[model samples]
Target chain A: MTDLAARQAELVRALLADGPVPAGFDPDRVRAEAAALLAKRRGVAARLRPDLAATLGDRFRPLFDTWARENPRRAGESFRADLDAFARWLQERERQERERRSGHRLD
Target chain B: MGLPTLGVGIGWRSEIDLTVERLPGVDFVEVLAENVSPDPLPESLRVLRGRGVPVVAHAVSLSLGGAEPVDPRRVAHLAAVAEAVDAPLVSEHVAFTGAGGLDSGHLLPLPRTREALDVLVRNVRAAQQDLPVPLALENIAALLEWPDGELSEGRFLAELVERTDCWLLVDVANLHANATNLGTEPGRFLDELPLERLAYVHVAGGVRHGDLYHDTHAHAVPPEVLEVLGELCSRVSPPGVLLERDDAYPPDAELAAELAAIRAVVSR
Candidate 1:
């Protein structure tokens, strides 16, 4: 990658993927920005996927935020695709919870 | 200099479609380019356009400043929307949204270096070629700055305008946030910009989150943000001013009153 592209990737990674604060940036401010960016993404996605957001109800934001912190958005992925991924993540999590409740562990 | 005068307007969201329609003296409306499709226009937008109100397509996913080249499909989508709505111009942002393979999901600030400027210029010109109308780039508010920026925000914007012949969509609320959080001088920042190339202005609401002033379009337009709008008005009569309220929309009367406040500033 070129220097400009590489540096932007580092910054993007730092914001969305819990990467390091980079060489010379202020850690506190960047952290705050990252938190804000995550929230904005969640908010915009929620607006786009009103059905999923309504289905998830109040848990939508917290659940999505948690999943987002881990999943992070892939560049060039459409918002529709990202929301679908969120829905799938929610389904998997629910299945795991149900299995645990039934005392049946499955792959 | 051929930009049309878009008296005063508000952002059109699905949630506030009716409110925007009823808002008195709404000269025009800007819709999110990503949310709209040219094939089948939304009924609400159709009604607004019927009333002779212009709709400007404001896109967020262009990533014009990304080191990676601008996406052709995204540019085409924005152009189609502009042609469908007959927008006098379209506006994106001066900042890049994401780069590489990870999307930050936020309009991140660019390091104001000449090398970065070269990348932005190339991407902007390429996108401009595909666009049917003039393209105006908005200045975004950033919570943090990249280390070792070679140029100030104003100088960077000036150079972009000079090189690409693109217009600007200056966000007054963002200027206020930068002034409070980054100690950016509003006067100097305005002076350094080429206002003649300004296509329009965005006035939104922001609130203070400790030391940082968050440009939350969900809140009421604070007096300080209005002060910045007033400052810009004093310098030059902007071609148009649009109010942006993305979330927690107030009542119809309240939104109208906010528009009135903006009208009051520009008419000063």
Candidate 2:
């Protein structure tokens, strides 16, 4: 793999290290799309708020793109709900990160 | 009869209650029903009324174009608030905010199709029937476009108003944003639209992304939108026009300055 590809894979690996890649998630595809998205503009991905970038990297792009393609016009609410879930998931991940560093879970 | 020519009115807020109460030259206050309590009207509205300020209710959460059933409870709430304030009209967005059971955190556009038109007409009719005064639907700033748009936004709006006999609340900022984003001419869009039906106009600021524009409402109104609104005022000369400042609020002086710019244009 190219150096950029290798670094991109490593980032994805670090993000997904908590568990097996969740069902229906393709880390390779996410990395590929992220790379392509980055290639179109060097700092484009970085411009996204960190939390949103990480969530899109890990969960949203895969879920919504798939759901939106399959359902087309019918996917209006479903598409939005999936993105909201992705944002909420990112919030949880940030909370977990804070907890791990603090030596106590929030719950 | 239509609403009278109320000079410059700012988007109503509770934080500025004292300012609104104490001010002498203010024309009308657009009360946000979403910000008020669920119960009938409150003392704040009473204060505006007592101060001899005409109050109009503007709704933010109606999701008028959503696929879900219109929330009768919320409509009832709006009706009660309108009655309480003795508002002349109640306005909501043409776009849907909540979809697929999730609040999108934004106003999304409906595709310009016959089906979408039918849906908008039905929703507007429902709101008009439930509310106390004439129902007004405002144009929205859309981030995306449908693949099969069959009509221009202005024409779509004209058709909706005609079908439902409803009034239009033209948000010039949104019109400008769509023009820049969609590669259309803002003046052309305004020329084609039925300007006479406009009951109110909204002007706000936005952010731009490479060839696209986003209506962030975080700054002073851009000159392009102000120009279109000026044209609207002369052509239609609507009763009330309100400036929508949802983010990065400038000081009252700055806002008043912007309002003055609009007044100078419309008055000319």
Candidate 3:
């Protein structure tokens, strides 16, 4: 890649993924910017899949933030994959909670 | 300069189809280019077109500033939508959405360096070559500034317009966000821009999140943003002003009132 292209890619990684804040960049500001991007994505997911958003209720933004921290957005997918992954993550958490509740009752 | 005085309009979305259809004062509607298929245009858009209300194709995913060349398929889709709508012109952002093969899912600002400007100019010219209608570029609201930027946003945009001979899509809400967050004066930013190149203006709503202003488009148009619109009109009345409400739509009456308010500002 050209130097400019390489620098641009590094900046995108820093924003979307957990890549390091590039040299000579303000770390705090970039972190804030990354958080803002994730928040915007969360809003889109909430709009596209209101059912999943409602199911997660208050924990929606936080959970999506956690997921987005690790997963970069796939081009042309339009967050369908992210929403599906979020739904499954919620289901697993619910299942774990159910098992814990049943174990407590048995005790 | 070829665009007519389209008056006040709204961004058409599926959620607010009935509202947009019934809005009386709307002169035109802008459809998200990515959302419509020319083979089967949405009924809402067809109704507007049938009524002789102009529909402008506005694209969000072109990623015109990305390091990669502008995707021909996306440009072709935009061309098809413009033809389908018979639009006077189409609009896309001056920002890049993705790099390194990952979609940012939102418009990200380009570094205001000469090299970045060259990349944007190249991509924009490519898209312009394919598009059936003229293309206007909108400046986006960004929270972060690249440390490597050498020129101001206005100078960078003016140079791009001069180089490409393209039109401008000035989003007033975005100006407000940048002015508030980046410590730039809105009027000064407007002055730096080539106002005569304006095809239309975008007026949306946003909220102040802590120290930053977020141009959410889901909130009500605040007075400060309206004031900036008023200032722009005082300088040069654009051919059109569009109200963009992507979500959290209010009642029909509320939406109408917002359109009326925009008309009042532009006509003043």
Candidate 4:
């Protein structure tokens, strides 16, 4: 890849993916920026689906953060679709947690 | 070619659709290109357009500065929206939104190296060719500055304009945020910029978080940002000035007051 293409790719990976900050750039600022981007997603998600925020309540951020790590928004994915996917993810997690508890009770 | 006079305007959001209609002295309004469909323009937008108010299409996901070539579909959508709304011009950010397999879902900053500028210029020209109306590029608020920059933001924009002859949508809130967060001299940026090519100006509110100013666009336009707008107005009377409030839907009274404040600055 050309130097420009490589740098742009690395920068995007560093920001959205869990990739290392490219050389010469400020690591702290890059990391801070990544966090800020996630924070922005959280804000939009909460506003988009207040029911999710209310249902999850205190667990919303932690759960959303987990879902976000596993699912970095795909290129060109609309915010609304991403949030709906998060709702599905949360429901699946809740089902698994219930199944695990029920299996323990059977023991 | 000269630009149309847009006068004072506000960003049109679905949440505050009624509020925008109620507000007075609104010469025009901008609609997010991604949010509207040209085939059937939203009722709110139709009402505004029916009143003979101009609507400008502002797109967020163009990824204009990405290494990848500009997406033809995205450019096509922006063009269709502009035609539907009868916009004088359409605008997108100078920053790239996402790249590779992941989407940041927010406007991301670009490195100021010559190599990056070359890629950006190529991508911008490609999209500009497809756009139906004149394309205006806006300066985004960057929280992180990449290392080993070759050109200042102003010089980079000036050169890009020189190469393509696109218009500029200067966002003063972003200027304030960059100055506070990355020490970018807003004054020097304006001086270096070719203000004659300005299409319009964006004025939004932001909150200072810890050490950085977050261009949230959810709060009232701060005095520091207004000062930056005043500075730009002093240099050149921009054809338009817009107040953008994205998330927190304020009351009609407050929205009118903010619009009035922006008018006061440019009216001078």
Candidate 5:
């Protein structure tokens, strides 16, 4: 890749993923910018998957933020994929919580 | 060529189709190019076209600033939509949406360096070759800037316009957000633009999140953004002005009131 292309890609990775901020950029500001981008993504996802949004209720934004940190959005992928992945994550968390509660009750 | 005077309009989103269709004063509607299907245009959009209201194909995924050459398939889709709608023009952002196989999910800023400018100009020229109508580029609201920027946003955009001879889709709310977040003067930025190339203006709402002003079209048009729109009208009466509300849609009366507000400013 050309220097410009490589630099651009690095900057994007840093913004979308938790990659290091490219040299000479302010880390705090970039973090703020990334947070803003994720917030916008949550809004779009909410519109696209209103069912998941309603089921998650007020937990949507925070839960989406957690899911987004681990899964950088792929190019040309639909919001349905993200919605499905988030739904699975929520289910898994609930199952684990239920297992722990059952264990405590048996004890 | 400049666009004809399209008095006042709103972006046509499927969520607010009924409100947009019922609204009385809207002169035109902009549909996202990606959402449209040429083989079978949506019924609501067909109704608007039937009513003699101009429908503009506005694209969000054209990533014109990406290092790669413009995608031929995306360009083809935009052309098909424009032809299907009989649109006079299409619009996309001056920013990149994704790169390196990862989608940013939002428009991201490009470094104002000469290399980035070269990439943008080449991509735009390539996209223009296939587009049935002229492509107007809108400046985005970026929260961060690159350390290697060699030019101001206005100068870079002016140069891009001069080189490509593309029309400008000036977004007043975006200008306000940049001015508020980046410490640039919105009026001064407008002054630096090539006014003759202005094809239309976009007025939207934004809210201040802490110190940063988010140009969230989902909110109400703040008074400061309206002032920026008023200032733009005073400087140059653009051929068209549009209000874009993506989510958190208010009532039909609220939407009508916003359109009336823009009309009042433009007619002044």
Candidate 6:
């Protein structure tokens, strides 16, 4: 294959290898779920700062790749669970940021 | 197929919305169909059309060079806009924008070979079938040269015209920028093209990146490109020559001055 074709194939392979985690895989699911949650949180953080969004996609993509690989057997369930946890975490984090901005203190 | 040669126009950007509506100077405006589409046509474009302004449709996102089938959806969208504005001419770049599910984020040059030409011809034929008027393809600038084993740029373009029977929207600025950046001879490139096939000419300004000059289309037309355009006009005698200002857009006042300069050069 030509260099361009080779590069394209490599990208497709990488995406495919990072498969969905299977059902009832609790430990792997928890880890992948946690990672995806963190990623969403980071995305929210990046949005408030444009430069971070620009630079972070590359850095953060590896995290997803790893999570996908770790939960490869139960990739779908784990990935979704992690994503749900991440979204929950992001909401809480955003609330805290808003509270902090408003000078509200937690005991 | 034979569009009247309306001499020296400018590509109207929506950013200059208020300016374009108020000004009556530019001989004509090349309206970007990509910007105002699927959404209602803006009030400004309607006013321009009503006032008998000759608008030419210029499009983006055709992805003509990509592996995917020509998106009939965009063609329908463009065809509607052309009829609405009564655009005498429509044009797009002869470069691919995205490939392999990754957005390249810019126009990417195709290798000038039979394979690439075949791809281009197929796509153009598909587009022209849907479009009311002939579709002209613009030459794009690139940093990398094809790894030989390909047709010359001129030959590829000339053959494309012959094969597809499409018109040429020659961007003199892109040709000049590519020649300077790629070390290709501009004069020879100009000479080899089928000038009679050109429907219009686009001239713009650019910046130098390292040793290579980039087609930024930011500034006023450079003297050399202008000189080349002057020569091109005499040789081809096309009806419309447009000045494209995509970045660092000068104020309408400054744009008027540039348009006046173009009018002088092309009319001469």
Among these predictions, the greatest lDDT belongs to: 1
Model 4 Cα displacement at A77 (Å)?
3.2
In model 1, which regions exceed 4 Å deviation? A49-59, A104-107
Q: Which segments of model 4 are wrong by more than 4 Å? A: none
User: Which has the greatest TM-score?
Assistant: 4
The CAPRI-style docking tier of model 3 reads medium
Worst 10 residues of 2 chain B by lDDT: B97-106
lDDT per residue as tens, model 1, B1-268: 5899998999999889988888898999999998888879888999998989999999988898889878799999999999988898999998888876888876888999999999999999899899999999998998998898999999999999999999999999999998987889999999999998989999999789899999989999999988999999999999899999989888899889999999999998
Better of 3 and 4 by DockQ: 4
C-alpha displacement of B177 in model 1, angstroms?
1.0
Q: Fnat of each prediction?
A: 0.88, 0.00, 0.60, 0.75, 0.58, 0.02
Better of 4 and 5 by DockQ: 4
Candidate 6 runs further than 4 Å off: A1-107
The TM-score that candidate 6 achieves is 0.73
Return the clash pairs for model 3, or none.
none
Q: Which candidate is the best by DockQ?
A: 1
Name every residue pair that clashes in candidate 4: none
TM-score of 2: 0.71
Candidates sorted on TM-score, descending: 4, 1, 5, 3, 6, 2
* TM-score between candidate 5 chain A and the true chain A: 0.85
Model 3 Cα lDDT, one tens digit per residue, A1-107: 87667877888899999898889677876887888888888888888899978877898878878877777787766577768877787789789999999999999
TM-score of each: 0.96, 0.71, 0.93, 0.97, 0.94, 0.73
Error of 3 at B251 (Å): 1.4
**A1-107 in candidate 1: lDDT tens per residue?**
89999999899888988888888899988998998998788888878898988898999888998899898888878778998998899899999998897886443
Could you report the Cα RMSD, in angstroms, for every candidate shown? 2.0, 11.2, 2.2, 1.3, 1.9, 10.8
What range of 10 consecutive residues in model 3 chain B has the weakest lDDT sum?
Answer: B180-189
